[model samples]
Target: MDKHFEISLQNRKLLYSVLKDTPKDVLCSIPSGFKNNIWWNIGHTVTVQQGLLYGLSGLPYTMNMEVANKFKKGTVPEEVPTDEEIEAMKGLLFSTVEKAQTDYKAGKFKEYSPYETSAKVTLNTIEEAIIFNGFHEGIHLGTVLALLKAVHHPKAV
Candidate 1:
């Protein structure tokens, strides 16, 4: 579990670096053939982790409903996020993982409602959800990388 948390934190840091380096316009742009942008993918990663871990455990998610609604599965970004909103999302990218680590250590997740992910993996416990989140985040990271490439070279696409 500690390794899981460590890896999650490391991935969040890498994501933060990517967001920092990416231009706001590129981050927000929904390139041709893509459903969402870099910002959406980053926020979605956080939202999914919150939903999978806290929501499944029947606990309130750390992020607000608005964020969850905007980035949750099956949703697309409706508008470009303001700088303030982007900063907030950047904060959440790392903070949520840190808080989850602390909460897990404190045994906050007492119950987990088993869920079968879209990939058909069943998460039967909080520990499983925590580990599964890494795989989920990695998938989104790949999407983010591809989005960045497309956004950086729109002419080529």
Candidate 2:
């Protein structure tokens, strides 16, 4: 569980770096042929992690419903987020995971509703959800990298 928690933290650090290094314009840009922008991918990763680990466990999510609704699965970015919202998302990228770690250590998650992800993987326990979230975060990290490349090299897109 410690290993899983460390990996999740590392993933969040990578995301924080992305948010820090990317210009606001590039982060908000939706490149040609892309359904969402860099910001959406990052927010989606946070939202999905919360849904999978906390929501499914019947625990209250770290984020509010408004934020979860905005970035949850099947929702496209409706508008470019304000600078304040971006800052909030950046803060959440680490804070949510830190809270989850503390809650997990406190044995807050007693049961989890089984769920099968769109990728066809089954998550039957909180531990499984935490580990699977690492894989999920990695996928979004790759998407963010591709989006950054496309933003930098529009001709390639």
**Which candidate has the highest lDDT of all?**
1
Tens digits of lDDT, candidate 1, 1-157: 9999899988888789888877788888898999898889999999999999999999999988887899999999888888898889889988899999999999999999999999999999999999999999999988888887887744222
| Cα lDDT over the full model 1 | 0.90
lDDT against the true structure, each candidate? 0.90, 0.89
Model 2 alpha-carbon miss at residue 36, Å? 0.7
Instruction: Write model 2 residue lDDT over 12-100, tens digit each, in one string.
Output: 88888888777788888899989998889999999999999899999989998898899999999889788899889989998989899
CA lDDT, candidate 1, residue 87: 87
Give the distance in Å from residue 5's predicted Cα in candidate 1 to where it truly belongs: 0.9
Count clashes in each candidate, considering only residues at least 3 apart in sequence or on different chains: 0, 0
lDDT of 1 at 82: 89
Model 1 regions lying over 4 Å from their true place: 153-157
